[model samples]
Target chain A: MTIIANAPYDFTSNDRQEDFRGAMLVYVGWARHMMFASPYCWPLPPDMPFGALVEGPMAQAFAQHPDWEQADWSTATWTRNGEPFTPDLSKSLADNGLSHKDSLMFTTPGLDGIGGMGF
Target chain B: MDIAVTKKKLGLKERYALMTRGLGWEPTYQSVDDVFPMDSFEGIKIHDWDAWEDPFRLTMDAYWKYQAEKERKLYAILDAFAQGNGHLTLSDARYINTVKLFINGLAPLEYMSHRGFAHIGRQFRGVGPRVACMMQSLDEMRHAQTQVHAISNYNRYYDGMANFRHHHTYLPYLQVPRSFFEDAASGGPFEFITAIGFAFEYVLTNLVFVPFISGAAYNGDMGAMTFGFSAQSDEARHMTLGLEVIKFMLEQDPDNLPIVQKWLNKWTWRGVRVLTLVAMMQDYMLPKRVMSWAEAWEIYFEENCGALFRDLARYGIVMPPCVEQVRKERDHLSHMAWCQFYQARGTNNFHVWLPSKEDMDWLSAKYPETFDQYYRPRFEYWAKMEEEGTPFEAATPPQQCQVCQIPTIFPVAGDPLTRAEHSCTHDGERFHFCSQWCQEIFEDEPEKYVQAKLGAHELYKGNLFGDADPTAEDFDPMAAAMAFLKLTPEDSGLHSDSRDAANFDLWRGLAKANEA
Candidate 1:
């Protein structure tokens, strides 16, 4: 499936982790929350605690959703890059095995979005 | 005494052969491989350049006469539309946003097509295709110009219409189409023809053009409708060239079938991703809808392309595997794409708004199986939020697919609620895709896609804001990004709140008073 080229095609990926200047790109999706359109991508320090992300950026990202107020993060189920996982609140993103460009989807079992229609 | 001699005129076939095939000569001064080095590199084998059947018998002299005539008629209409204050005659200011999308997103691709054709026209060893590509190159250039001339009248009275050329380069959402053309233009000659010619022009052009043109007609836009009419003949030639190039490649050698098939798969998925914008426009942007995106897909893609693939089947080319996924998505593509645009409206050059009750009813009727059940509820919730003065806006940019450059807004096939997410790590770096099709395209050409300048990635990295320091403590990144994209505050936000809407009301009121 290699590209047919006259010469060898080689280059560095444009968005490699080092290009972020000390921040790692992480994507967060609130599962069943179609209201948000798609997963939000942000650049954050890998050493930042997972709880801080949920409290700071992730909370702000989903604050407009009506179900955000009713959702309990502690009881939420999580998947990292489509695999099930549990995050220790105190653990840094790096400690929780979250790498650059890795996507995390969280679902609050009780909060199924507005009108329970998965919005 | 003489000889009075009258020379007989050349017949159509003779003139075509003399004008096309007669133009080529054996390269004795330079080796043929040295002159046409690009043709062989893509692994397509052409045993005889002479075997290429000229699709159109158009000569340069006749081409100039025909195109000049089209331009003359088109410009006359454009001038009349302007003098007649045609911008005031549009059904609504919301319809202008669709034109904005066209000028910003699609017109620039026409220019890119011009460049691609011009490049490949010289690269092909066959004189017949060379002549065909050269004509198509001129046609594309003319299309780009006429479109700009047509929409330039709207630019005077609209906010988003201004800065289209700039937006095509830097606008985040526009990168979907920008990158699609760039991907095609950067490929080899065969891949370029197959990607833009066979896949985009032949298979998908109707979906893109029919909606915009018919929407223009339905929405009372004479300028855009006239431009559409002007371009229709050129599009027919381009489609014929598309089919001709594909058949020529396949018929030339058996080895080309698999290569062409691979490209068909890749470009079909790629073209579909780019058309998500057009789908959204058909469904949401047009005030007086011509047809629903689902209906357009059923007609343009499902029916027309279905027949085309069947025709191609005898040449051992089956439908692209991605067609199944596209069928699953046909019902929901526009809804999802419009939702994405609506949520991220602040960042886009064009304005977005919640569909009216009537519009929602139209959507319900159009998309019986999914619209009311899946999309209407979401729109209703957003409308409620807008009523409460807390309209939902995405706080951060969505992750973009590396291949398509579209925000990963597509839902999983047959599953309307969940977003489709696929990613793969190459050389210890992760690249995300909207679906398995995009992932496969990337897997095939990791070398090419890995170098993608993803818009969101660039936004975060501070590369998008030209000469501005994003790291400054007081600097606002979003504002700076907007400045870089040349989008004024008037250019974006809710359609109801936009300056275009305000001006439209004022002018129409004035015109009515004058009539009285």
Candidate 2:
């Protein structure tokens, strides 16, 4: 039950425990799912303050925002071995249980942002 | 002669028993291990071969009669479809692209299954299972041949419909399926049975076949529908064999449970990964969508897989690993794949385009939660660019997954512009995968995947088009790529802006005029 920190920009290190392979793969799929849906969420206008919210509230806000349209937050209710995982987006992915060495499933919002399915 | 003629006809049970267990006995000349070396390597223990049950009890004579009758009916429909110019009746010309995907991606895998089942039929020690495998081997061959015959009708009118078997061998996108079957075929006997017999046939074949048939029925392509219908009966038998094989292996010994579970996980993921093509076809290619890929996945996988896992729980097996990932991905995969094809048509052999406004609305309705929000803008962006006379197509090939060979376009969840690249160092060389499952697959058997011929690597190393320098003025990478595929512009890869788009517009214009 060791909890690893998340680092969105880094992927050099990842969890390789034999027992965690299945759950780790689930997280990887979630990472891809989020990246795919990120384009729908436009960058906040320059002066707006950036904030992180729990997935339940974020989903509601996204649904109401006509511009955001039908964003999928299925993976936003993230799970670790079928248990719910809520990470703080305000901090680096490492603070949220994603790390370059152990877990690589977060996004660095400004510098690299997210790479898309469209190369 | 008169006395001998008084013998009665053998009943079904007696005939099957004699044909199966009646012929088997312990061998005196060679050790059982020597006789069946392939079975033991996987650590599957079987105390008695007689315990195997031949479920079909289908003799060669009955098999021929059953199959030939079905083929006669299918060929009759195929002949009608061809002779009546039924291609003209499809929902749209773009509908043929779905057929193209089928012929190129799936048909050849059927042929490969034929070879796989044949090999395993000889490899297994039990006579009952051997006979069943032999029957399934023939069924697979028939599926391949009939699929080709049915779709060959399109070859007469379409650009990318020709030379499917050849395309499957060399096409980059097609490598997803080719590598999958090759992995299964090259494995031990039990692995092959579970990989093809169980995971592929029983679990995932419906995802592929159902969409095509229903899509055909909706689009008025009787040829494909007929071919699919003809194959369905045999598919049921193959699926039964798959289920029976798994249950038999599990029931035989407790030690066999974990190994079988591992195979179930490996092959289930592998098979589902390949179904990315079907998902794309169902969601994007068909002119008349039968169901969204998400809904189909829910029916075929989530609901069905839940029941299947419950049944297997008694044997101490859970669901295939990471299947929840597949459940989560159902809403997103088809759209992602369709967008990838639209953007990268230059590197592929199929036609793709931005969905029409109506089609987009339909998608939004079908995927109410995700489409308009996450996927539509991408399509809108592409379509707007096209309208402004600056259509977007990739100038360079995207880096492909080391194992699956798909491009690195899969999104990292929550980030639309960035995708995940999972990699590992194997034998001093770095390898990349599109997802953790593929990466883990490589880690598990680095030897099996290390030698894969990635398209980019091949071109960079000057192994293509007679080793000509990639920088030479006369050298064209696309041409080099096509040269390896034996494809020419006339009858090969269909371009989105080419005749396909024009024909679709033409059909739409006529429909509009009729409506007016």
Candidate 3:
């Protein structure tokens, strides 16, 4: 007879656009290892629909944002547990199948590199 | 004649009793041995198949109907979640990337088990176990389907979930789980059970499932939780099968204990090494916290297995000797292994998904001996590099462990900095690697890991350096695949990297880094 959401609700909400953007940045940082850390970067294999986030139209669509830089990820903007980890972005370069070059940026929350817990 | 009273309609349990215990007919023509031959390969002998106890004695009519109902409930949950932009409510779109990692790295193995259990279903001489496996075979297919469907909701929101069976060619993390299953499936049924059922499902399932459920719960994605819980409830049954099968073998003969021990050691460590991603996922991947790998290992492996083995030891089956080694590794491995992922050239990064200091300090306190003593100081060294405007430079990974394919981040078992990364020579040619695990696996069994004449980066090394061929035509992924599978170059097989076949090289390479 009781609903989980309405049961004396007290959980925090990320309702602001800034919160959403910040969360995105934190996720971007969380994904830092994904870009440069794997043998071949980009989250999925090239044939998968998800791989398009890196190589195809969506990649281009995101690339339209001006805020991103080739090394924007490595720029020490946030900290975790007071121990800083600048998403070792060297993986993002697209040159020589080594790093990424796409410049995709979004506005608001600065979630990337917020120390131990990025979000 | 007086009419006999009709037999009372049976409840589920009574039906389970009749269908399982009474339905199987005595073979009029063939002996049980003639019907099944795989039981003796690991030299495990069972005196009696009837003695095997199956707690969930599912009969066919009820089995099919319950399975149908479970599926109906599962699909409805998925539909409601998708109809809702439940995707956006998730911690972030990137969390879906973690789910993507789960699918590419882990899902195919579920499908493979569908075939594996089908074999076990038909081949087990015991009617009880065979029937259990038959139901399990069906469960495996449903698991594979549900896993894909659960993540497909993110196909529009993320990139990694799409056409991923083919993604093994491009993503190295994906290659890790794929190659592991490929090797397990290629081995005998006994090895498959050791590698999959015991090592993966029984020993490692809690560590995996806990993070998975919490990830769904924290992100507000009920669909994943429903699917995960369904698959996991079935997994509880599979774990029982693993334990029963192992005990059945041990009960058959005393010699079976040693063989099972070796398998337990090898697969346990291998499984743990691969689960490093889940380690990072629990520790750092989620925006909200989940149980740490250290805590999970303590409860799942230490406490549970400790008790299980204590029970087994009474039968003269000693506990797995490697338990202490595993307990030690769990302390520093998530940190070390995640670093391997962070530092390896083609591995995934832990950037945007960093955890908090309270969590890190908690990590340090929990793993005081390992973290405070070894890993923390080491990261400090790297931090010094980044602060000096020169985050420490990484070298090209040695080609040998390159077979294991993880960076040399894992130091010798006890020493974190000794960096014993080395190579061996076969016929005057040198092979290099980052860790002894990778090197020993590669050198002791070269045919196991090496696929001859391939490297996506090879042409650039030779005359093709100037060709501007965006397609990586020359690289072969067989070695990479072997490394991923806990196999090495010394052992030769059709799928091994040592194979001379060109198409094998091509497909194998595609399976690794997706070369054209």
Candidate 4:
């Protein structure tokens, strides 16, 4: 299944960690919130706290959703790169074991998008 | 003494042979393998170049004459349409967004196709297939030219059409088509023909061209309809060449089957993913919809491509495995694509809007199983938000598939509510895909796909902004990115709020009135 090239075909991934300067690319998706269409990718420092993400960018990203106001993060379930995990609110993303391009998905069990159909 | 000399005119078949395969010669100074270096890299076995048949014996002279005649007739109509202020004659101004999508997203691919064909034509050692490729290369170039000419008329009357060439390179949605063509063109000769000629031209051209052209006719766009007509004959030739090339390779050697099958699997998935834009246009953008995207898929992919695969089965080429996933997706592709476009409208060069109630009803009727239950409520909520002066616009870049390079917006199969997310770590770097098929394609060619210039990644990396410092305290990233994409405030937004809509109302009103 290798590429049948005349010569060696090798190259660095264009979006390698170093390409983002000092930031790591983290993708966040709200489970069942189809209104946003897809997960949003943001460049944030690895040292930034997980609570800062939930309060600042993630909150802003999902603010327009009807269920956002009623969303209770303390009761919400979370996954880091599709695996179940609990984040410490005060801990940095790196402390939560997140790396570059890793996806974080959150589901507010009670707040299932607008009209309970995942928008 | 009077001497009379008689010369016999060569018959069509003899003339064709003389003008085509007869033109090739054995190289004296260089080896044949050295000259056609790209021929063998893909591991396709070719025993005899002479066995390659020319599906259509269109020599350079005949090709020029026929195309020139077509050009003459096409231009005359285009000229008449232009002089008559034909832009105002059609359906609603929103119809022009479909044309904008075509010009910006699809037209540039025609140019890419030309380059692909031209490159492969020079690489193939077989005289017959080489000539066929050469003629197709010319046809592709002509198609690019005629498409630009036909659609450019709308530029004078539309906001989005003015910067299409620029948008084709920079727009995130446009990168889907741009990257698709670049992938095909960058592959070896065999892979290129199979990807573009067979998988695209033969299997999927109907889905792409039929909807756009028929949609044009339905919407009173005589100019685009005529362009479709002009290109129809060339497309027929291309399709025949597609079939001929595949059959030729299969008949030449048994070893070629598996390689071709793998490519067929890969390209079929790739082609369908790229056509998400067209699906959105057919379902949402067209004011006078010809058919729903689901209906088009049933006819084009299921019915037509079904027969094509059955025909190809004798050569041991089964229907691509991706079709099962595609069947699951047909009902929802357009909805997902349109929703993505609507939220990210500000970043695009074309306008997007919520489908009218009638449009939704049509969608409900067409997609009986899913539309009303899943999509309608979402659109209704967005409309309500718009009415309340709080419109939804996504400021952040969406996650894009590493292989296809489209935003990973597709919902999980059988579960329409959840977004499908497939990712794998390769060489310690993470790659994401919208579907398993795309991930498999990446897994098969990790080296090739890892080098992909993903648009969203590039945007986040601050590669899009030219001289502006993204780090400057006052600089806005989204605004700077939009500026980089050459999208003006008037160029993109809700269709109702667009300059195109405003101008259409003003101009059409004056055209009907007794005085200005």
DockQ of each: 0.81, 0.04, 0.02, 0.81
Best-to-worst ranking by TM-score: 1, 4, 2, 3
lDDT of 2 by residue, B128-185 (tens): 8988988989989999999999988888767676778777877667888898889888
Q: Between candidates 1 and 3, which one is better according to TM-score? A: 1
User: How does model 1 score by TM-score?
Assistant: 0.98
Q: What is the TM-score of chain B in candidate 1?
A: 0.97
| Worst window of 10 by summed lDDT in candidate 1 chain B | B203-212
Better DockQ candidate (2, 4): 4
| Alpha carbon lDDT of each predicted model | 0.87, 0.69, 0.55, 0.87
Off by over 4 Å in 1: B1-4, B471-473
Which residue pairs collide, candidate 4? none
lDDT of 3 at B360: 64
Best by lDDT: 1
lDDT of 1 by residue, B1-516 (tens): 889989899888888888888888989999999999898988898998888887678887788999999989999989999999998888988888988998998899889999999999999989989999999998989989999988888888888878888889888888889888888988899999889876678666777777668888889999998888788678888888888888889899999999999998898899898888888888888999878888788887888878878989998999999999899888888898889889888878889999999999999999899999999998888898899898888868888888998888887899888878798889898889999999999999899998988877898788877878866898987778778878888888899998889999999889778753
Kindly indicate the candidate among 2 and 4 with the higher TM-score.
Answer: 4
Considering DockQ, which of the candidate structures 1 and 2 is the better prediction for this target?
A: 1
TM per prediction: 0.98, 0.79, 0.66, 0.97
